[model samples]
Target: MLANKRILLIIGGGIAAYKTPDLIRRLRERGASVTPVLTSAGAEFVTPLTVAAVAGTPVHTQLFDLTTEAEMGHIQLSRSADLVIVAPATADLMAKMANGLANDLASTLLMATDTPVMIAPAMNVRMWDHPATQRNLATLKADGIRVIGPNEGDMACGEYGPGRMSEPLEIVAAAEAALSDGPLKGKRVIVTSGPTQEPIDPVRYISNRSSGAQGTAIGKALVALGAEVVFVTGPADVPPPEGVQVVRVETAVQMLDAVQAALPADAAVFAAAVADWRVAQAASSKMKKEKGEIPTLSFAENPDILATVSQMTKGRPPLVVGFAAETDNVIAHATAKRLRKGCDWIVANDVSPATGTFGGTQNTVHVISDDGVEDWPKMAKDAVAERLAQRIAGALVG
Candidate 1:
């Protein structure tokens, strides 16, 4: 899929830079040519000679090299690539890109590039969670830069949380998606996944059993079809897919706000299992358990994200899809929900304990629309997502 593609790969200064040689090799294996731009800090981690050797191209480092500048200016070099990728995009590098600072060759190329850009962030857990870094991340996403991963696992720093760079093959997959000219190439989509957490206190919260597997699968399928996906997700067991903008939220209100912020899309899919209610007055501190006494809790309804978006007076998505997880009478309930919520379609499924649909890999779904219910055979969640994505592509661009 990446045959004859030109990828300008920027290696940032991080332990994960060691993976770039492999990334370059993989890209080359698929007929993609990689031009390596090694930062000064990146050079400290991996030698420029090594990068040049692996990529089979001269490593571009100096911002003002007399020899190279005469041959090809930075502007020309930046615009030559089909896609520019920053693997192990450090926090410092991301901040520079977000703020539009171009002090070095990598940042300068990023600022000057007209080509689509993708970054695989790698940083310490604390750095990744910092508010400033997150703000920069949001800014970058708003500017239409695609992000792959900083997958969660044991980091080199001995602390564990979402700060590891994605593996090389995963990056390759994302690159393929970015370069795909599929049916939904120009379309933008919003996909909400996972279970929203309604905080009751500093520690306790109300949530559901949604594993986010289905939603993640949907996001991946959409990306594969060439849709620019804005994945607004909650805390889920499964990680958000690469090649999409991921907005993380904790509550239904936050999710709604995030979705609203990502509006004007071709379609919106609400696959999240949001908590219906939240504690009216959550305790500031943890509520202590007392012997022979039960604490009375007051409940308030959470925001109806699906209904609100579906009933939008302005800037509504062309197609609004909602998910209905029913215990019984799946088709009937889902059909009713499609009308009641004012959504264009409803992907309904039985989530009873016997079905194991909530967190399981397989699902039996009924696609409910204005025409009627279309009951689908039981299939893997990934297969369901692929079929749904095809249908969505047909609706939007066929």
Candidate 2:
């Protein structure tokens, strides 16, 4: 995915700096050329020689080096890469980057570069959890810096928490995402995921069997394609994809509200398994059957989120995609749903117990549109999402 990409890798001060050589190797294996910059404190953990040996290039270590300065100034150096990555982003380096301090070569290059930036944080467990560090992280995120991980593990300091750097391959994947020149680049998209819960009472609710695997994968694929994603999610089985705006909701009404609020999107993918009905009047407290006295409940039709978004005369997305999980007549039902919901496309999948699609990893879906129904072979949910995202990107580009 990262073939021929140019990366400016900045090594920050931390014990995790020792992993930089491996990271460089992994990135190079994926066909990315790494230009290394080593901070003074970072050099303490991993020498420039080790970095150069793995990267197969001279490492940048000073802001005022005359030899390189005369050949290519710091401004050129900063502008020379497609993306800038900070591995083992120390708390001090993060503070400087967040506060716009440029007292050193690393900070100065980061400040000068207009390139997209991603950071992999590494620090002591306590330091990683500190309020100041969190504030800096928030600031950096607001400034559009993508963060990979400070994965939780036993640290060199004998602390176990979210302070370790991500593995080299994971960092490589993040870099690929950052450098991807997919067709959806710069497009804003909204994806609804998971099963919405309609409350029956304080403790009881109506929901579906959806595990949110498909939707989460869709969001990840979209992010990989460089789209700006607003992920409006319900109660999900999987955690949300990194580097996207996440909005959590519960009921179908709440989901609709959140979706409406995230308007003006280029496309909207309604992959959530929203409940069809909700309690008309839920009890204030949980109800119990006492002495064989059964309680009666009334149902109300939920707001049709897909139809509402699709039929919008103003601020409607150019493309709208919906999912239909049917037990029988899948293609026909999905076709009708596409027309009835006024969506551009409907992904129809059989969810009969025999198919095991409700909470399973694989899906056999048919794409229904004005063009016609296209039957897709059964595949992993992630593969389905990737195909769908690619098609969406194509539609948007067209």
Candidate 3:
């Protein structure tokens, strides 16, 4: 997807450093040129020749290399790219960036370059969750740095949680999107996603069929476009996006609290399939089956979060977006819901037995607004998110 793009690829120390060679080749195949810079730790796992061979360029290593000074000055090298990427970004590298440590060539180039920077962190699970590392990550995000995965999976350390480098293909897509002038830049957007689990006991509750793929994709697309995204997620089957600010919640009440905290955004997208009813009085302990004939459960209504946000007079988002998952008369009901809830738009899609849109990667969605309903062709969740994000930005800046 990246054509005619220049990327400064900095390889950091970690087992994941081995993937950088293939990463370089993929970038070149997509018509992007890569200038490789190796960290001291990176050299231990992979040789300089391997990187140079794949990059088809002489690798840059030292901070005070006399040969490189005679040819390409460090100043020239730092700003020659459209983007800077640090793959296999170790905890040390992350801390160094956070503290503005410029002792090394890679760290110095990072601080000196004005171009947008992206990092794909690869560290042990414990290191990833360390208080210092977490604080550093928050600092980086607040500074407008874009980060890709450090995804959750089996690691070289024989542990699994959330500290694996993103696949090369995934990083390439982010690079392509960053180089392009996205249509949704500069919009402040909020998206609520997934099923809320209301507690019946400590162990049981009610939820929905929301897989959360579409909602999280929307957040990612907005972030890629330079929009400020606040993702309020419930008990989602999928994890949140890499760069967006995520507020995790479980019950409907908790979701409301998160929404209020993320307010004053430009747009609010209520994509979560929140449960309509919850247990009024949940037992602390699991009920014994021996004494019960059949449990008569008491139910109560959940607060209409979409309507509340839509009707807010102060600190309300400009364009409020909501979703309607209906069995019949989908468009008509969704259109009525928009009017009733005072929202600007509603995206209606069939979640019935015949259709597999629920929890599926592909969706055929109908966009309902005051203008009219537009039947969009079936597309991937990520594509849908981009289109919606673009429209949100257009509406905000119109």
Candidate 4:
């Protein structure tokens, strides 16, 4: 899809810099020609020789390298690509860009470019959450900059938080999504995500193994296509995308309420792994074990959020999407779900032990519609989401 695309990839300083080589490889594999620009601090993390070996070209390092500047110059470099991308966009670089500081080669090119810019940030969790960083992020978003990541997970610092950069393959997918035309512009989209936790007591709750990555990526892709997104998310480890209007909920009831509130949207995706049942009667206080034997607990079906929204009377969404997680007979279950839920489409993924679809970073999905089933190969969740978003956009605009 990226054939003949000129991608200017800027490497920023971060521990995740090691991923740059593989990023170049993946981009090249997809037929996009990569031109790398390295920041001063970025050079400290990875050798220029290493980058050149993978990108097959000398890395641009200086804003005023006399010999090179005499030829293309920084201004020429700025406009040479179809899109400019920054991977491992450090806190320092983000702040610089937000403030329009062009002291370095990367920031200078970024400031001068008329092309759309995308960034994949990686930094310490605290740095990512600092007030200053937050303020800068707001500035960048308001200025129409595109950001891909800084996903949440266990960081190299032995901390589990929201500062790890998205994988290289996912970064390439984001780049492709950036190149895609804004077919969903002016449309409204709603996507629900994560596992809704139903409170069992003061301290305990019933939940599932959903990580919210796929659904959140779908929301981001919708936003990228110029859609106003209403992202109803359960408790998630990653921060919501900057432009979307987010609603945080913790149970099936809460999620259902949020989905109803987000109606009238052009497209709606129920990607959340909502609990099928909640405690029949939740105890206000913590339930204590009296004996060695386990206590018997009653269960009750929770609200079917997807079905309710699919059949809503008041400004129902034009296209309704549901997700089916099945252990066996995946295709059969997914097709059944599409009819039963009254949704326009259903994405099916195997969550059996062999597949590990519940909380893994990757997913292999079958996009089932009335037309037929499109079996998407195993890929990072973000790629699937972006492709799904593109499909939705085509339907909406057509």
Q: TM-scores for all candidates?
A: 0.84, 0.66, 0.74, 0.63
lDDT of 3 by residue, 1-398 (tens): 47888889999999999999999998999999999999999999989999999999989889888877776567777899988999988999989899999988899898888888888899999998899998898778657676676766899999987788888876776676566666555455788988899988888888888999989998888877766566788878898875554667888888988798566677899999998989999999997677548888999998889988999989888889999999899888998999999999999988887778878888878999989999998899899988888778778775
Model 4 spans with C-alpha error above 4 angstroms: 185-190, 199-203, 208-287, 291-398
Q: Could you tell me how far off, in angstroms, the CA of residue 62 lies in candidate 3 after the best superposition?
A: 1.1
Off by over 4 Å in 2: 124-135, 150-163, 187-213, 227-350, 359-361, 364-383, 394-397
Clashes of each: 0, 0, 0, 0
Model 4: which residue pairs collide?
A: none
User: Whole-model lDDT, candidate 2?
Assistant: 0.89
Better of 2 and 3 by lDDT: 2
Q: Scored by Cα lDDT, where does model 4 land? A: 0.85
- How far residue 285's Cα lies from its native spot in candidate 1, in Å, is 5.1
- Local lDDT at 49 for model 3: 98
Number of backbone clashes in candidate 1: 0
TM-score of 3: 0.74
How well is each residue in 1-398 modelled by candidate 4, as lDDT tens digits? Answer: 57999999999999899999999999999999999999889988899999999999889998889898788588887898988989889999999999999898899998999888888889999998799997887787657676666667888888887788878876776677667557875566888998899888889899888888888888887878867676789997666665565667899998988677555578999999999999988999899988787867799999998899887777778899999989999999999988998899999999998887777788999999999999999998889989998899888887
Against the reference, the lDDT scores of all candidates come to 0.92, 0.89, 0.84, 0.85
Say which candidate scores most in lDDT: 1
